[model samples]
Target: MKRSAAAFFVSVAVLAAGNGVRADGPDEHAGRAQEYILANDFDEARKELARGKPDDVGIATERARLALYEADCDGALVTLSSPDVAKTEQGAMLADIARGCARVTAANVLEEDHDQGVWIRYQDENDRALTPLIIETVVKAREALTRDLGATWPKPTRIVVVRDLLSLSAMTGLPYESAQTTGTVAVAKWGRVTLLSPRASIHGYSWRDTVAHELTHLAVTRATVDRAPLWLQEGVAKREEVRWREPGPFDDRPSPDAIAARGIELKLDLPLDKLGPSIAMLPSADAALVAFSEVASFVRFFASSTPPGSLERLFAALRDGKEPDSALEIASSGNLKQWDTKWRAYLQSKPKEPLPPLLSLGKEPAPNPKAPSLREVRERMRLAELLLARKHPTEALSELERLQLVGAAGAPQDDPSYRYLRGRVLMALADPGRTKEAEVLFQDPKEVLSSYGPWWALRGVLARSRNDEAIAEPSFAEAVATDPFDVEAACETLDADSPTPPSKDPSPLCQSARAWKVPSGTED
Candidate 1:
C-alpha cells in the first residue's frame, strides 16, 4: 500500500542508464523521460522523447517499457526488436518479457465503484472470485482512511489486481525479484494500487490487510499532497492497516518482540528529519527491513504518548501547506529533533526478548502449486489478444473459442475478453448481421469485469460503432476516468464527447455502470 512505484521503479530503471547516461540528468532528454516515467506520466515521457533524443538507447528502452506498462507484450516486442534496442541493458529485460508474453491469449484493464474506487485487472479466471473481497476491502478502507485522516481522497483511486509479479513489476518498473528486490505485496502510487491476487502473498502477509494498507497510503498521499515524509507515510500505514481496539491475538504480524529486536540494530539511527530520505534510499534488504520496523515502532510510540487529536492535527498541518519540520512543531510542539530524543528514551525502557528469524506469521512458506494456478488462463487469453493485435480476429476467436472449453468452466459467459473477442471477430470480419449478437457481449459487464475499464471502453467502442450514443457516452466516460493511462479508454472517451450535464444531474446510464456488480461471486 505504501510504496510509490515511481520512486522504486525509476530507481530500478536507472540501472541501465544507457551508454552516455548512468543516471537521470536534467540536461539530457533521456533523463527527463525517465523522470516523467517515474512520475507515472507516460504521456509526458513520450513528449520528452518527441522533443529530442528520440534515438537515445535509454529513452528508447523507456518507450518500450511503456508498452509493457499497459500489458501489451507484442507491442513492446515490436519496440524492442529493433537493433538499437537489442544493444541496451534494459532491452534485454524487456526482451525476456516480449519473448515470453507473445504466447499470451488474453489482456489487462478495469472500471468504477459508486464514487469509491475502481476495480481493475486483466482478463482471467480469478476475476469473479476476487471481486467481492476487493470491493469489501476498498469500501472498508475508504471509510477507515477517511475517519483516521479526517480527510477524503482528492480523486477516485484505481485498485488494480495483478495476475503475476512480472506484470506488476513491469507496470511499476520495480524488481520484485533479482537484485533490487521489494517484498511488496502491493503498492499504492499515483493515486492507484497494483497488487497480487488473494493467494499471491509472499512471506506471511495478510491479503486483506495489505489492501487496506495500500488504500491508506492513497488517502495519506492526497492528504499531504504527496509531501509527507516517508517515515510518517509508512509508519502510519503499517499501524492503521488494522482497525485499532485493543492488542489482540497474533495474526502473525510483526510482534512487539520482533519489532523491538529489529530496532536494536538502529541504536544510532538518524534523527527523524534526516531519517526520512535515507529509509527510501537504503541499498540493501536488511537496511529496508530495519527501517520499516523502527518507523512502525516509533509511530506506535508517537500515537500512544501524544494527546487525543495530535496525530490528526499533524496530518492536517501538512495538508494545509506546512513544511515537515514546521508541521511537526505545530502538531506536537516539538519537531523531529525533540521527538527523536523522546523516542530513544522510550525505547530504552522496553524489556529485551530473544528475537527469532524474520519469517511469515503463517504456516505456509510460499504457496505450493497444488492445483491450477492462473498461468494457464492468462496464457490462453494473452494468445488471443496477440492474435487480435495482429489483425487476425478470426484466428484470435479460434484460440478464444478453444479457451472456453476447458479453463473457463467457472467463468461467467459474460466474461469481457471472451465475449469481447466474439464481437470483435464479428466486427473485424465485417459481419453486420451478427453485430446484434456482438452487442450482447458488452451489454451486462459483470462485477468482475465492470471495474475493468478496458471492457467498458470496449463496450463504448462497440456501442458507438452502431450509433448507440445512449450506451457509448457513459461507458466511455467510466472507462477513461477509471484508468487514466488506458490509451483506448482515453481516446474513446474523447471521441464519444459525451455530454456533460451539471454535476448534480449526471447521466443515469453512467451511474449504473459505475455501480455495476456481478450476480454471484461464488459457484455455490
Candidate 2:
C-alpha cells in the first residue's frame, strides 16, 4: 500500500493538534475527517462532511482526502466549491495539501508505462490500488522462479492484472460454480505469464503463495510444453509453491514415521506425457481434483526420494523434449508405467479418511421475504465464477440466477457486475434460446462490467452475430488489451479485422495482436 509523503505529513500535523477540541461540534467532525483520511476511508469522510453543517475545514479537508486516495486531482478540485470552505485558514492549508497530492498522483500516473505491462488501471478510495501491487507481485514471482529454477523457467514472460474477480473469471472461462475463488491463474503459451485478480489481498503469504504456485506452473509448462503430463505439471507447480516456503501453514515437514504412515498412492495409471492435454478436460470435477492432488504428491515423492541431481536430470530430459515415460525411466532407472501402478496400488491400499461435510448443504434457508446482502451476492457471484472456470456452466447458471434475484431486490439494476456475469453464464450455456438474454446484458453500454474481458468477449460474439465487425473488433481488442496474456482473446482479435471507428486507441491492442503469431498448428 503506497502512501504519499505529503498525506503522511498532513496526517501527523492534524494528529498533533490533539483532542482538546470538544466532541460533537465542527472541530470534532474535522478531527474525525482527518482520522478517516489517514485510514484511507475517503468515502465515509466525504459522506460525513457532505451531511454536516457548512464548514470550510470539512469540505476542503474531504477534497484533499479524495485527491490523495484516488490520485484524481481534477475530481478533487471540482468538489472544493463550497462557499464556506472558500474563506478560512484551514481552507488555505487544504489548498496546499490538495495541490501537493495532485502533483504526486499525476506524476505517479504519468510515470507508469502501459506498453511494458508494468501497471494496471484501477480505482480505489484507499492506498495504492490493487492493480499496481499485482503487477509488482508478478514481476517478483517471475524473477524468483527464473533465479531459483534455471532451466525450467519459460522465456519472454508477462503478467496481466484484471480489475475484478468477475473479469478474472471471464478471461479464464472459469465458472463461478464453486465456493472457493482462485486469486490467480497461469497460462503458458508463447511465454510464461499469470493473470491475477486485483481485488484479492496483496499482502502476506496467501498472495505470495499464489504467485509462487503460478510461477511453478510456468516452469513446469516450459519444461514439458506439448509433452507435459498433467500429474507432473500439477505436482511440480505445488512443489514449487512449497519449495519457496509459500505454502506457509501447509509447509511443515512430516516426521519420517508420519511420512510412512501416509503412504504414497498414485491412483491414475496414465503415463506422464499423456497428462498434459487430458487433465484440463477431465470429465468429472472430482477426478480433476484427484488428478491434481496425485500430481502434487508425485512431485513431492520425487523431490524427497531421489538424489539432489536426479530432479534436475528429469527436468533436463523434459527440456530436451523427451516424453515423461522416457524421462522418468532415464532419470529414475525405473519403468514409468510400473512405478505408476505401484504408486496407485499403494494409495488404494491405504485407509481413506471420510470427506468433510459440504458447506453448501444443510444450511438453513433464508428467512422468507429477506433478500441477500450485496456481500452475499458478491460471494455467490464469485462461486459462479469458479464454476465457470471449472467449466461447469449448468451449475454456474444456478448461482447466477440466485445473484440476479438478489440484484432485483433494490440492488442497482444498471450495475455492470450483474449484467456481465449474466452475459458470461448465458454465453457458456451456448444455447441459442439464451442468446437474446445474453445479448441484453452485452448490449448495455452502461454496464460497468463491460470493461472486463468476458463482457467484451461476449460483446464481440454479439457483434459477430449481427455482422458488425466494427463493434466486434474493438470489443475483442479491449479484451486483449485488458489481459495481454490471454491467448484466446488474442486469437479472436487477430482473426477479427474489421475497420471499425476506433472505440479506444487501437495502437496497443493492434500491435500486441500482430506480435502474437502462434505456430501454424500449435494449440494453446
Candidate 3:
C-alpha cells in the first residue's frame, strides 16, 4: 500500500508516462490541467501542470487541489500561500483544511466494493455502512437499464461519490447554478458516473433514483453516441426512475392525461421538437419543471399510442446519424406539425381533474372606517380561497388582488396569512412572473407571527423552490412541531433527514412521521 497520497500520485504519474509534459505557457497549461483533473485523469492533470514548472501561484493552486484529491495533505499545504491557490473559494477552503488533514494519523485511502459486474468507489471506510445500500442500488440500476436498453454493460461501471457541488462542477464542467436549477442528481460521463457524497447533505434526493437515472444516461449515451435530443434523452431517463420498495416493479410513469392537464394550465408547454436544448437553460425553475413534465408526457403517450418499436426506432435513427427532429419524425411516422395536432387533440380529450384542495377556508372579514371591514376581507378571501381550492388560480389571484384594493384597513395583502395564500395561488398558476411576487410574500417579516403549521410549510416550500434546502429543513421541522399531522411538511423535510425515511426520527416533533409513507415524486 502507498504510504501517502504523494506516493499514490507518483505511481500514477510514472505509469501514465515516464517523463512529464511541457506546455506553451501557464494560463493554457493551468486550464488544460484543470480540465484533466475534472475528468479524474490525475496522471495527465499532473503531467499538464508540471509542464509549466508553475512559477505563478495561481497555477500552483491547481496542483494543490489535485494533491488534496489524492489525500496528499502535506503536499497540498506546501502551496497554501500561492495566489493561484487563493484564486477560488474552493481552493482557499482546501488550503485551510490541509493542516487538519495532515495531523490525522489514519491512512487516507479509497475503498471499493464489487459485486456482479458493477463496482462502487468510496472516499474511505467511513462509507462502509452505506456500501451495502450502494451495491444494492447499483445492481438494481444495472438490471433496470439492461432491461430497457436490451444490452448488458459487460464491463464494470464505476460509481464515484464526490464531496460537493464545487468538486462536481470542476469535474463535470457544469456550473454550480445550472446544477442547482436542474436538480442534477449525478452525471454520467463516458465510463463512470459521479454523484455528490452522502455527506454533502443535498437533502431530499434519493440515491436509488439517482443511480437509476445516471445508469440510463450511460446506456443511452452509448446507444446514441450522445446525439439524442435532450428532451427525449431526459424523458427516457425519467422513465427509468422507480422506487425500489414498491410492491413490485412498476412503470412509475406519471399519467399522461394528468401531465397534459398540467401543461394546459402552464402555457409555456412546448411540443417534442420545441422542448429546447436542455432543461438547465429554461428561463425559470417553473419552466424547467413544466418542460420536463410535457416531454415525459409526450414520450410515454407516443410509446403507448404508437407501436412498441417507435422509441427503439428513434434511438436507432439517432444511432444511424439522423438529426433529432428527423429521428422524432421517423419515430412518430409523421411530421412534427402533424404530431402536434394529434397531441393537442389527445390533450383535450382526456378527462380534466382538479388539483388537490390546498387552500383552507377563513373567517369573514371585520369592518373598518377607512376601507372594507375585516369581515368583508374575509368574505372576499373565502371566495378566492374557494377558487384556488377548486384549481382556478387565475381567477383566485384576480379575486385576491381586488380584495387587496378594497380598503387600507385589514387589507389581505398586509397580513402574512393572506400573503401566504396569495403566494400559493401564484405557484398554482405556475407563471414565472408571479414567482417573484410569491417569493416576496413568503419572505415577509410578518411570517413569524402566524406560527401555524401551514404557514411554516409554505415557508419551507418557498425556500426549497429556490434550492435553499438548508433553510427549508428547519422551517419544515417547525411545521411538524407545530402540528405533527402536517404530512406535506414532513414529506418535504425527508430529504434532509435520514438517507432513507427513518423508522424513528430523533426529533420528538416528528415522532409521528415514521408511520407516514413518502409519496412518489422526483426529489432526486
Leading candidate by lDDT: 3
Ranking by TM-score: 3, 1, 2
Which stretches in model 2 have alpha-carbon errors above 4 Å?
1-128, 131-148, 151-156, 163-186, 196-207, 224-226, 250-280, 345-355, 359-524
Better of 2 and 3 by lDDT: 3
Once superposed on the true structure, which residue ranges of model 1 sit more than 4 Å away at CA? 1-106, 109-111, 115-117, 176-180, 201-204, 244-248, 251-258, 265-284, 357-524
**Least accurate stretch of 10 residues (summed lDDT) in model 1?**
10-19
Cα RMSD (angstroms) for every candidate in the order listed: 17.3, 26.9, 16.7
Sort by lDDT, best first: what order? 3, 1, 2
Question: For residues 417-449, what per-residue lDDT tens digits would candidate 3 score against the true structure?
Answer: 576677778887778888877777767444322
Evaluate model 2: give its TM-score: 0.38
User: What is candidate 1's lDDT per residue for 386-418, written digit by digit as tens?
Assistant: 676667877877765664432333223544445
lDDT per prediction?
Answer: 0.54, 0.46, 0.55
**Full-model lDDT, candidate 3:** 0.55
Instruction: Give me candidate 1's TM-score against the actual structure.
Output: 0.48
Best by TM-score: 3
Q: After superposition, how far is residue 78 of candidate 1 from its true place, in Å?
A: 17
